[model samples]
Target: MARLGAGGMGEVFLARTASGRPLALKTVHRDLSREPGFAERFAREIRTNDRVRSPWTVSVVDFSPPDTAPQWLATEYVAAPSLADWVHRHGPLPEPAVRCLARELSAALVSVRAAGVVHRDIKPGNVLLGAERPYLIDFGIARAVRDPRRTRTGTVMGTPGYLAPEQATGAVAAAPADVFSLAAVLVYAATGRSPFVARGEEPDLPALLYRIVHDEPLLDGVPDALLPLVGECLAKNPEQRPTAEEVRARLETAGEQEWHRVVPPALVAAAGSREAELRGLLAAAQPPVYAPVAAPPAPLTPPVPPATAPGTPRPAEDLVAAPSRTRKAVLAALAVALVAFVIVMIVPFGGGDGDGDGDGDGKDGTAPAGTPAPSPSGQSPAVTSLPAAWVGTWTGLGPGTPDADGVARARTQDFAVTVTLHAGAVGDVMGAQVSNLKEIGTGRNLGCTEALELRQMRGNTAVLAAVTSHPTDRSAAIDCPRGNLYLVTMTEPDRLTLESEGAQSAGAPAFLTRGR
Candidate 1:
């Protein structure tokens, strides 16, 4: 009937069987199907899903043959928004709701374990807030408890911020890991933030992994009633963490009435409307046309921002109705690409040998790769100089509104940047900077100090590359994206605009004035 969502593996759609029963159909990406051993893994998930039969899980209805192109698996369609979606669009669930979520998800895990399965991936995005109870979906990375297949060393699977300490270190996840992840999800439900989250900053992949392995989770916001049980579930040692059965037993089961009281009436109404729309389309004389789903649409009305400590940054996505949790999940997936790029591209710019030059390689850095060269000289070519009009310290505050085609596309968060550009050549090093920037889509503030390298300059614009970026605060531990390009174009002698060409969540261009 419509596209449900997409992920790293493939696209999902709201499909139907001959009997008109709605199903969530996931089709493998053609490119992913070509990867070695992908088919086997997909088949394994199908087998795993078939083995577990629980009211808390979306039951698998049918699947494609292992040898088929674009292999697919169809499961019962869940009209409810995911726990991540609900928490993101609204706010953290109240204490009663968190308790109910914990109890139900624990039961879901228990069922999977009894079926000899280990759900390696269990996070907010995988949990749906059904009218009756939450439903655990997506077993793409699940493994049979005694399957005997070994994962490669140094290859970790599962989302960060919810990974068990062992899983963070690339150890195979077991039943205990699922429990740890469930606890993490419950933390997110009780509080608007991930347990491993750094104060006032968006969740960083590297930092979350490190904290999972070495640091205690920030449990300050978890409700008092669920604190002890959640703490035990998050135990660093897998053996010490309670089993799924134990976790289920500890929490009182929440009846349907309790669930109704906890879930937002509007969210349930929205889901009901969506189901009605699907059914209407199915009854029509013509089949409904399906298009690729863009970022899930924001709610019709803006939600109230969740309350936080005075200095803490609220999840900005809540400030206005914008793209939902899909944005966060997509950003989290960037860790895979970020790691690969760092190893290949950023390694050359590793922290320099104590001298002021920022290049890590012993040799004085050459001109940035694409710079137009001056006539060859025996000595190192003199560094180019920035045009007089382009040199200055420019500052701009993002109005939290995009100005493209004179239409507001996405509502961005408050973003502010102060750029100090010095007259220098394409590879000359600058001192450093630590800017606090809050971009749209990403839910938290970002503080990064970085070494700047002039990369290029066209007629009216000069390009600066963030060669080395380190987080300026403990709120986030990972370094900012290296080699990010900031495009500065001069609108007037003393005024300019800056647009980030790299980070997608960098938000709209910021118009700036001199000496602000």
Candidate 2:
């Protein structure tokens, strides 16, 4: 027996079947096997995993409870190392490879969602970098869509660095949460460090989670096209994040063809036996049917034995000839009609519309002259208006300190400024400052800069970056820490907030309405 690895749950061993077929057999830990509910959950996982069919997902072969011996489950043995191992050997993955990894893993999540299963753990350790393609392993934490108990315990089941905000909060998560985890994994693959690393000694999981839930990620080197999708996936609110299918669709639209590589020989050989075992299990689950044989012809009268010695012979007049040509033609026509009826019954309808016009309207389906054009949501006609005045720099308060009374006091400082819009075009110094000043000031310097670069403005929000000081120490000496930068954006019309560690807010609208 070849030992693969051991964990808290169980020990995985490389084993061979009676026919010399290789397989990976995982036996449940002694302690877990003794638990009353472990068996049921394990059985459910096996059953659910069996239903999942994806090239990137591992296949389950056999599962046996500890009725007479130790409980064990067998899965396809992928020979490649985990993503974590690969990263350890080679520094960080290249940008293209990182994007490729993200696309593939996100597509895998799509499959898992289709199978009615959520892979709660999507960290690097659970992802295998096979020779041909990546595979998602360890469905140990996989729960069916309807598993209430899985959420009730609120167990921190996934890796700390890769968990979504909702997962960290012990909230019930859907497929989007997996996407969030995948985004984090991609970030880690791009950069050697996790995106949410703390400055001090050890990173605080709760604080990191709070940041993930409330703030945008610090994506400095990530590609622009991929960053937006990653941001959507890592949205603080689960509802705001896109679905797995949406992620796959967008990635495909972005031209992600030829991403799947050939499977390595070792992995292919290992997966083959496991797949065969799964087929056997399915075959065994179904019962076989035998067609009835026609009864033997009835015996003729006994008196016929005198003439034929064994059977009586029918008269030549009793024999009937086959149908006539006209009759055969009519029968053929009836058969054809029956086939056409069956096809109509089985084939779906309304599949395609010419030129992809879903409503089946003509190419020029427009309103007549003098008629009002229909607006989205069928509301009042939209009015084109000028940009608002509050599109420039606006500041509020800053973080405060505790008073002598120890009642959690804060200072009423007016150091906060929110830039709604940048003035000029790209490469223009003034416009660059106004556009990216907040991001540079906040992310680069912890919000210590007097003036920063304005990266871009969206609606009422602006992303800014801090400018480098002539002498780093000189800026620090002047009480303006070089690294004290921030990224501030308007949450809505009412509130202007900073994305610094100490988020400051002012002019918060009492009833701020969301814009499209």
Candidate 3:
């Protein structure tokens, strides 16, 4: 079996059926399979997916959920190049190709919606490119329409750049949410990048969310003929976006004559590339006897942004409502794709995993065949420079209004962190104490007064050196190991965000609200 892909929840591999037909198999890692109710959720996802019948979707073949230590699912093999890989290597799909993709994907949504399912995660990596019937894959996080059990625990789901506005807030996604994500996908197909994301960047969730909620999509280079339709689909209000049926109709009718475009040359070549790569791998390995295999943890799906430091009362998913630690366990499963997408781990066909990270083949500064194109602007943050956007205090909802027993808070608990730009040589610091902390971590929380040194920047993220502090009156010096090593832009000027590079608590890492 060749390793096909992996994410935070499980890994996928290519396996041959008893009849010698190739099947894509996914095995749930042991950790998630052990969580209570996981079996039920996985069971639900399969049940809904089985009902979706679209030429555009990979057909679900079979699954094993025997209440055992590990679980696996299989789908018909689709060995086409991924849209992410194609776009990463070649600039963007031609206009006619983009229109064709929209029409077929919209058709896929019809089948999904008819089955009462929502494909909550529909980014480019989940789409495959082929000469005939390019397929959509990875419905691992999909849910039945109005399925209340879906993510009720408040875990943030969906990719940052592709998520629908309501989905970004952790609300249950509906069919229209898929339309929103598909619009983002089309933008990437046309421009070789996310509508809201620049290349080589870790999306700032808060800003990306803001764009989904309030800003116009960045459809800069989209073909004029297709722009209006793509723009309408990207509207902030779900109700305002076109229905899947309408999207399909508009595309087919508008370009009735161009329907025979089949697949673009780049995409056809991409298919050839996958076959060659797979053959090379097969040649080096010995044929193995068939046997069941375990899969690695799927991509990293990060949890909801940590509560806005204390009192600011930022909106958060209703994760506090879940009655048990199962939410935490589920969070581990929800990494964006669900939350794994928050932290995003969707694996591209040739790219390592779906985070757009390369496989380290750039020793000579030449991007390998499947590597993402170099960023169009901005250098790595190694120079210790700060963007003007991150110069203020940001606020967010603090830990939920509870104590596991569902008790309420007194003053809403103020939780705010600030970034100050120092004059000359002092430089800027992800420094300063976030206000209002009755209790934070098991260790002594670092103060904002003791500045953590800014080290470098990676795309939209800023890296910082570990900070160590000694308490007054000759107290023990505390070293915050890997504490606050990076900062992500939540919202320019007012809200900046960071996920702990090392030290972290359950559902933390949110932003600046008020100016200090």
Candidate 4:
């Protein structure tokens, strides 16, 4: 068994399946399982993770059935190292590499939001550097996009230095919180120090939080182009931040071949060497000796059948080689980020359930497929009753929309969206400079105008069954399959919701209200 490292929740191990397929298995510490209400909380977290499916975000593969208690969760293993490992080994990244990292990380957030997930942990240790693309790993603390009331106040979660000012101050960590964390990670990548790091002094958690809430970042070393945008992300006001899509649009001009050669030769050689060792481990006559730790005994050899494979992504070498916790940079054994301040293990499902996520693929960026339809309070009515409140301009910043906080928090870009519904059909536009989402080309404040007919309405649910032509909009993908089948449900008289129907879900149900 190739033991990769440990995290706040459990130990990550590299193991093989019966097919010899590689997987990364994180076994929950036995102590946590004994806690009251842990079983229910664990099950809910799995469901939330299952909703996220993106090439950029690491995918969680389930080996346990619905009824059985899962001892572990497995994810696709990539051969790479944490962003921290690479930066520490190779020094700060060049402008081109940083630009590439920003773009890819933004794109990854695009998917993460699409699946209604806000990864609370966006630190360097959670980011994996692949052969070409950078992947967002460790969705252990991800929360679904929903009504904000569900968040626990003063949770005091996540990494100390990476925590956004709002998060540090015990405010709700919506999408903007993630944006702030990602920006901090970028600063570290570009300058070898967190933007909040005080010069000539050891980093202090409380002092850092105070500075984050009240001070401006010292980023003299950052490129002129990225300075303001990243600063905006680190803004104390969450509403002031831009979305991930917007960031991607701004950086889109950086270049298409940006991802190439982002890695230093030394790290690449190290990765190759680790891969060779992993391959050899598959056939070793005897497994390596277990180096015991003060905590629970390290597994003699990781239990097989459904373990995370090594030489897999985030190669065992991917983690910094510190004995206690390899996965993260600062604390390896206690994997949770909070700098040992406060770590909460339970996965809290946000708020009230709404309409179903139309399909399992998550492409249309809808809700989870099995969201409990409104019951009384939530139940869809048997009669085909349409409320007049549906007519009006509904606007909110969400995935694919500029100024979308979800994109901002995910360390991605933003595209604002506005839709006008006139009882029968709806006209909508998202983004700027580049308005046509079907065939995306980033631009500032550009509007993509398209029409979707509300073909059916039942109870509080309304389905946009077909797309209509907008002859003036050149941004539309003329030849592509672009008719929108996304669902829009009205949970309340004044509230409007939009969700995807395909495999790739877009940043949760885009909750909107009339006129802003």
The candidate that wins on lDDT is 1
Cα error of candidate 3 at position 255, Å: 5.8
Q: lDDT ranking from best to worst?
A: 1, 3, 4, 2
| TM-score-better candidate, 2 vs 3 | 3
Model 1: per-residue Cα lDDT over 417-486, one tens digit each: 6677676777776534456655345544555667878765444445577788877655764345555556
How does residue 401 of candidate 2 score in lDDT?
Answer: 21
Q: In model 4, which regions exceed 4 Å deviation?
A: 63-70, 142-153, 254-256, 283-516
Model 2 lDDT tens row, 1-516: 333444445445554332223456655545555666766666656655665668898766556632523566666665555666556556666666677777788788888887677777777667777656777876643341122222333655466667788877777666777888888888777765456663232455566666666667766666666888887887887888898888888877454544333333443454444345434433322111111112112220111112223353543222111212324453344323222111000000112100111111232212212222221111121112212432354544333221212111112222233333444432222321111112222232223323455444333333344554332223332223232234333344434445431112212122222222
Instruction: Provide the clash count, candidate 2.
Output: 43
Candidate 2: stretches off by over 4 Å: 66-69, 140-154, 198-201, 253-516
The regions of model 1 sitting more than 4 angstroms off are 142-153, 253-257, 285-516
Clashes of each: 0, 43, 47, 70
> Using alpha carbons, what is the TM-score of model 4?
0.53
lDDT of 4: 0.54
In candidate 1, the residue pairs with backbone N, CA or C atoms under 3 Å apart (3 or more residues apart, or in different chains) clash, namely none
- Write one digit per residue (lDDT tens) for candidate 3, span 1-516: 444445655555565432234556665556667777777677666655665666777666666634654566667766566777666667788887787777778777777777666788898878877557657776754331122212343545666678888887778788888988988898988888778766676655456666667777788888887899888988888899999888877776643433235567655665565555445434432322111112111221112223454553533333222322433443233222121111123532223334332222233212112222222221222324554444444455445212422111112223334445332212344544333232233233322333556655433445554364333213334222223344343333344555443222222335545555
By TM-score, the better pick of 2 and 4 is 4
Better of 2 and 3 by lDDT: 3
Candidate 3, residue 281: CA error in Å? 9.4
